[model samples]
Target: ALSVLMPKVKVKKNAKSGKKGKDKKPQPKVNTLISKPKAAASLRRKLSGPEDVPVPDDDSGDLDEPAAAKPAKTKLKAAEPPTRLTRGQRKRQQRKENFLRKFELANLIGKQEEAFRTGSLANLADLTAHLEEDKAPATAKGPKRLGRKAQAAQDEREMAQFQGVLGFKAFQADPFGALEQHLKNSIRLQKEKEKTAAGKQKAKLSQLKEAFRSKKRLGTVKNKFAKSRKPKK
Candidate 1:
């Protein structure tokens, strides 16, 4: 009777007013490291939506469409038959046979697994010993790096390939003076052009003087009245 009355009173109060704590919003999650960017609403943000899907030129539902569209399939693959074996395949088959033979000799020491499951304590101990040995992890070793001489030879080959004819010509044309003489000649011609441009101001000033003189009657004065003043009246 007391428990029923207690819940009824609390329900009546909840109906009248909601609790302040209950009304409060949950806290937003805070990232301690990298956070995803809020995507902008358009293509300017560099993000694509599902509707902006890219369509390939040959998007036909057939798998062979791309293969058929490809030009002549110019791959220089050897024309060996699929059933043929390369040298590596032969080596792998030999290795597999050797491994199976070695495994058979090793397993001959132990009887069938069923015998051990229903056998004496000594057999049980031997099985446990075998399992323990199998579980013992082997130490793995990495391949050794190339020696200094090997590395130097590899770098020399690379340089010879990339440097090709340009480097060979440079070395042959001038062992002591690379292409410095040719570079100097180009610089000298550029400086001569600059000097000619500077002298153009003098030529331009002489042209201006000639143009001024050609604009008139000669004497630097309008003295026609002095020459003919009615015979000195």
Candidate 2:
């Protein structure tokens, strides 16, 4: 036999809730551009030189007196004079740091070059690990910064072994300086060659333009003379 489903019972709504509630208007938004009393106090403290910041007076719950009537007093400590480094002294310190950094980089590059010349896999592997340790991230918080030009020179010197045409020997005396000088000479020669080629091209173009102008003038002259010699129509 089929079973019948039970019907759901409905509850009646309360008559009191049927009445409409009073409509309330939304509160106006406060403009932040107009400074509040507390913000004004902070600004006053900032404008007043580095002495102790004045605290704003707090209003008690009792509606007695407004905070603006009496300003809170702050104990001002005497400002200490700033320590400024002299220009010459700053330069000397910077130069000293730079010299130390250059010395360190030179030593590191020398080791890599020696490893390369020795043809020892273990030495090269150790050099690789050492280089990884000396990377930019290692000095993320330090004052040591490797110059881009120096880094580029080091990279070229390392790859010079594969560049037979360059005839660059990484194991030579002062390999870094030698390779850097060689790279500078190469760049200068390349620029000179480019300048010479550009000059030649410009000369050729000027000659072509002059030749065309001459031909055009001759054609115009010939046309004018021919027109002058023409028989009366």
| TM agreement with the true structure for every prediction | 0.22, 0.28
Error of 2 at 190 (Å): 0.5
lDDT for each candidate structure: 0.66, 0.74
- Kindly list the per-residue Cα lDDT of model 1 for residues 1-233, writing each as its tens digit: 22322222212223446543454444544432214334323332344435655657775765565554556657787887778888999999999999999899778745556566667465667778999999999878887899999999999998887677356787587755756766787899999999998789879988988888865555534566567655854
Record all residue pairs in model 2 with backbone atoms less than 3 Å apart, i.e. clashing: none
* Residue 140 shift from truth in candidate 2, angstroms: 38
- Top-lDDT structure, candidate number: 2
Q: What lDDT does candidate 2 reach at residue 107?
A: 100
Predicted candidate 2 versus true structure: per-residue lDDT over 44-66, tens digit per residue: 56666578656567745435655
